[model samples]
Target: MSGTSSQGEGSPGGASADSVRRRRVPRAERERQIVDVAVEVFAKRGYHATSVDEIAELAGISKPMVYLYLDSKEGLFLACLHREANRLVVAFQGAAKAVAPSPELRLHAGLLAFFGFVAEHRAGWVVLHRQAAELTEAIAGAAAEARRAVMAEVADLVRAGIAESGPASRLSAEDADFVAHALVGAADSLTDWMARHPGRTPEDVTLRLMNMVWVGMGGVLAGRTWSLEDPGDAPH
Candidate 1:
C-alpha cells in the first residue's frame, strides 16, 4: 500500500521531474533549433567538411540526439535545404502578392524579396544555393525543385503581363516560359554580383533588373523586333 499512491507534486522529487518535463522543448521546436545551428555550421564549412558533432555541440545537444532527430547528416542537410527553399519561396510569394496587381510592380517586389533574403540570410542562401547542388540525387532533386518553383512564379507573372498587353502583345505562353528561364538564370548569377557590390540595395538591384529586362519586355510586347540588319538602332 505504501507505493500505491501516484507521484503527485507533494511526493519527493515528483515536482522537480514535473518541472523538467514541462521545460522540455517540443519536438518540432527542438528540431528547428538543431537545424538552425546546422545551417550556420554547414554554411561555414560546407557539407563535406561539416560534422554532425559540430552541429550537435553548437546546438547544445548530443551528436546522437542530432542523428536521432534528423536520422543522419544527409537527412539533416536535406531538412535544411527544404526549409530554406520554402522560406525563400514564401518570402518571394508574400512580397509579390502584397503588392499592387500590376505585373511589373509584382515582379519588382518579388525580386526585391529574393535579393533581400540572400543579403539578410546569407548562411541560408549559401546552403540552398551553393551546397545543395553537388550532393546526392535526392539533394540535387530538391534544389532543382526549388529552382522550378521560383521559375514557375516568375513565369506566371510574365504570362499575366503579356495578357494585360492585349492584342498588340506579340509574346505567347512560350515566350513567357522563355522569359522566366532567362530571369531566373540572371537572378541566380547576379547574387554573386550583388555580393561584390554591397553598396547596392535590393531595391537598386531590382530596379536595375526591371529597367534591363522589363524595358525590353515592354518593347517586345508592343511588337518591336530587333535584327542585325538594323545598325543605326544599336547603342553608341
Candidate 2:
C-alpha cells in the first residue's frame, strides 16, 4: 500500500511540473521574443533577404503568429529599428547624466556609451546603421527621426559647453548645431574604422575624438582663430 501511495504521489508531481513547463507565456513577452529573433535575422540577412518563416522557426512560433504580433515584415523591421534606436539613446543619456556636469566629461561618457553599444550589440547596430536606409519611406523616416534625436542631445551638450565658456566665446546656437552635426558625422564614420581595428577599445576612440574636437573648440573659445594662411597655428 505504501509503495502504491508513493507511486501515485510521484505521478502527480511529475504531471504538475509538466504543466508548469507548458504554461502560456504572456503576450508582450512573446512579442518581444519574436522581435529579438527578428533583429538577429535582419542583421544577418538584411531586410530584403530575411524571411518571416525563418524568424518564426528561430523563435519557435508559427509564421502566422509572427504576422499576428507584428502585422507584417515591414512592421517587424520597424519594431526592431525603434527598439534599438531607443536603447541607444537611453544608453547615451544615462551615461552622460551619471557624470559631472562638465560638458567635456559628459560628451566623453556619452561617446563611450555609444561605442560600447555598437561593440556589445553588433547585430542591433547593423540593423540601425546599415539596414534602415534603402527601404520604404516610412522606414527611412524612422531612421532619420532617430538621427535627429541623437543630434538634438549632442547639440544641447555643445550649447552648454559654449555657455560655460562665457561671453568671450564666439560660438552661438548655430555654431553649436554645426558642431553637433560634425561630431555625429565623425562618430558614424569612426564606427566603420572601429570594426576594422578590433583591438582598439571604446575608451581609446572616445579619447581620440575628445582630443580632436574638444581641444580645438577650447582654442576657438580662447580667441585663437585658425586661418589658411597660418595653418601652423592650428592645435596639434
Candidate 3:
C-alpha cells in the first residue's frame, strides 16, 4: 500500500506533477509577443480603431490572456510605441558611428537609416506617424521624449559638421536650430509620402534631400560660401 501510494504521488500523470512541468511564458516574452501583434493592428488601423480583443485574436490568444500580459488596450498600445521608438532611435544613431566621415556622408547614413526604418517597420512607423488621437498622455510623453533625444543628437552633428567645413562666423545659433528642425521635418513628412507612393526608394529620397540642401550645405559650416576662382587669373 505504501509503495502504491508513493508511486501514484510521484507519477507524471498526476495534477501536481503536470503543474510543475507546465510551460508558462515569461513576462518579458509574453509582453513582446503582445506588443508585436498590437503593432500590426495599430499600424493597419489607427490606435482608436484597434481593440485588445482584435490583438488577442491575432496573437492566437484569448482576450483575457492579452490583458494578463499587457493590461488594457491603452496600455498595450503604449507598450508598442515604447518598443518601436527605442528601436528606431537606436537604428538612426547606430548609422552615424563611422569615425571621421564627412558631414555629407554622416547625413547620408542618418537619412538612409531613417528612411530604411520607416520602410522596414511599416506598422510601427505608421503608428508613430498617425494615431495621434490614440496616444494617451503616457504614450505621447514617451514619444516626445524620444524625439527630443534624436533632435539633440542631430543638432550636435550639425554643429560638428559646420565647424569642420570652416569658420561659419555668420551662422547664428538660431540658424543651426532651424536647419536641424527642417531636416527632421522634411524627413518625417517625406517618410509618409514615400510610404504611400511605394515607388520612390529610400536611396532616391536621400539623394534628393542631399541635392536640395547640400548645394548650400557648406554655408552651415563656414557661415559663408567660397566662389570658384577663374583658372585664367591664377592668383600666382
Candidate 4:
C-alpha cells in the first residue's frame, strides 16, 4: 500500500505530469512580453482602468508572474512607457544620424521618423500621452524628462538652422528657442490628428508639415518679412 501511494504521488496522471514539465520562459523575454501587452491594454483602456490580470491574460502568463517580473501595476505601466519612449527617441536619433548635413533636411528627416513611429505604434503614443495627463512625482517626472530631451534635440536643430541662414534671416537664441517649442507643439498636435485620421499616410503628413514650416523658414531665410504694412508681393 505504501509503495503504491508513493508511485501515484510522484507521477500523478500523464497530463498533469506533462504540465508540470512545461518549459519556463527566460526572465528577460517574459518581462518584455508583459510590458508589450500592458502597453496595448493601457492604451485601449486608460491607465486607471487597466488591470494586471488583463495584461497577464493577454500575455499568456500568470498574474503572479507579472508581479514577479514587474512588481506592480504602476511598475508595469512605467516599464511600458519607458520602452515605448526609448523606441521613439532611438528612432529619431537613428534617422537624424542617417540624413544629409543640411539642417532643414535633418529636421525633415526627424519629422518623418516621428510621424512614422506614431503611425506604427499608436498604442505607445496613447500610453505616453496618458502619462502626461496622470502626472505623479516619480513616473511622470521621467516621462516629462523624456519629452524635454526630445524638445532639446529640436532646439539644437533650430539653432543649426539659424546659423545656416543668411544674416538677415538668422534668429537670436531666444527666437530660436520659441520657434523650436512651437514646432514641437505643432508636431505633437498633428500626431494626434493623424491618429484620428487614418486616411492620411505618414509621408503625406510629413510633406504637409514641410510645406508649412520649411516654406515659412525659407521666407525668413530669404530676408522677406510679411507685415500688414506690405502684404508681401503676390507669389509669381
Candidate 5:
C-alpha cells in the first residue's frame, strides 16, 4: 500500500494514508498553541520585539499557520492579552466570591488574588502591563480594555463601600475615581517593589497594602477623620 491510497500510508500502519495526507487539528487546540507561543514570545521579546516568525518557530508550525488561526502579530498579542487578562479577572472575582460579606474583606481577597496571579504568571503580567504600553492601536486598546475591566471591579467595590457606609457618596464620582486610582497605584507599586525586595514576603506586601488601603478607604468613606500618622509615630 503506497502513500497514494487512503488505506496504509507510512511505515507499517504508523501513519494512515489519510493521516499522512494531513491531519487537521481541532480549532480549539490550535488556538491554544498559538496563544501559548504568543505569550512566551511577547513576554520574552516584548510585544514590539516579537515577530510572527519567532512565534512560528517556537510553535513548530508555519508562520501562515499562526496567521491562519490568529491573524496578524497584533492579533496574536491581543489574543494573549485577552486570555491572560481574563484569567486574572476570573481569579480575582473568585477570590471576591468567598468574601465574608464585608467590602473590606472582599477588597483584601481581591488583592490577594491579584498578587497570586502576578506571582504565578509574571510573564502574563509583563505582557498585559508592560508590553501593552509599547503597542499602539487595537493592541493598546486591548490593554485599556483589560485595565478597565480590572479597575471596574475595584471601582464597583468603592461604590458599594459608599452606598453601604453612606459617606463615600458625598465625594463626587471624580473623587471616588481619584481614590480608586490612588489605591490601585499603591497596590501596583508595592507589588513591583515587593518583587524587587525578595526579602519582603509578597503576603507581607499584600497585607501592608491591605492595611493602608482598607483603613484609609474605610475611614474616609465611613466619614471618620483623616488621620495623618506623624513620621515619628510609624514603623520604619
Candidate 6:
C-alpha cells in the first residue's frame, strides 16, 4: 500500500498527476493575450510611452517571450491594431445583416453595434483611434487602413439607402460618398464622447445619431433648404 499510488500519483482530491501540471497556453491564445495587454498599456500610456516590458509583465509573460511571439514592438502594436479593427468591422457587418429590411434600420443597427463595441472594448477602441496616431508611419498606416474599411462599410449603407429611396432621395453617387464620410467622422468623434460618458448606453447613442442623420436625409429628400441669408430659413 505504501509503494502503490492510490491516487495515481495525484493529490487525494482525485485529480490525476498530469492534470495538476502547469497549464500550457496554445500559441494562438498566448498571442491574443499579448495583444490584449498591449492594447491596454498602449491606450493608457500612448504608443510611444508604452513599453514591451510593461506589457509582458501585465501579460504574465517574459519580455523575451513577447518579442519572440510578436516579433517586435511595432509588430505587436500592428497586431493590436489589426485585431481591434477587424473586430469592429465584423461587429458592424453582423449588425447590418441583422436588420436587413430597411437601409436606415440597418444603419441604426450598425451604429448600435459600433457603440456597444466601443463601450465594451474601451482599451481596444482607444488603441485603434487615439494611440494608433502616435505610432510610426507603417503602424499608423495599418490603423488608417482599418478606419477606411469601416468607412467603406458606411458608404455601402448609404448607397443602399439611396437605392431604396429611388429618385425621391435625390442623393447622387458623389453625395452618398460625402454623406458616408460625414457619418463616419461623426461616429468617430462620438465614440470619444461615449468613452468619456460611460453611463450612456449604446441604444441611447444610436437613437441620438439616428435622429440627426435621418432627419437631415429627410429634409434633403423633401427639397428643403436653409440659408443664412433667409432669416426664416434656419433648420429646426
Give model 3's clash tally.
3
Question: Which candidate number has the best lDDT?
Answer: 2
lDDT per residue as tens, model 6, 72-178: 99999999999999999999999998975888889999999999999999899988888787668998799889989998889998888778765666678898889
Most accurate candidate by TM-score:
1
Candidate 3 local lDDT, 1-236, one digit each (tens): 43333232233444453453353445687678779988998888888878877887776566766776666887887788778878887887788765347767777787888888998898888777677434688878777877776777677767766667655446656766788888888887898789688999888998998787765666435454454674453221
lDDT of 5: 0.75
Error of 1 at 199 (Å): 1.8
Q: Name the 10 consecutive residues with the lowest summed lDDT in model 3.
A: 2-11
lDDT of 4 by residue, 1-236 (tens): 43332232233445453454454456788788788889899989887888887887788766766776788888887898889888888888788879889888888888899899999999998888655447556678778877887888888888888888868775688878888888888989998789789999998998899889878877776676666776766232
Global CA lDDT computed for model 6: 0.83
Instruction: Order the candidates by lDDT, highest first.
Output: 2, 1, 6, 4, 5, 3
lDDT of 5 by residue, 141-214 (tens): 88888888888888777766777886444655676677678877777677678679878765777798877777
Q: After superposition, which runs of candidate 3 have C-alpha atoms over 4 Å from their true positions?
A: 1-23, 225-236
Which stretches of model 5 miss by more than 4 angstroms?
A: 1-15, 20-24, 167-172, 199-201, 226-236
Give the better candidate number (1 or 6) by lDDT: 1
Candidate 3 collision pairs = 162-221, 168-222, 168-223
- What overall lDDT goes with each candidate model? 0.87, 0.88, 0.73, 0.79, 0.75, 0.83
Displacement of residue 176 (Cα, Å) in model 2 is 0.6
Q: TM-score of model 4 relative to the true fold?
A: 0.85
Worst 10 residues of 5 by lDDT: 1-10
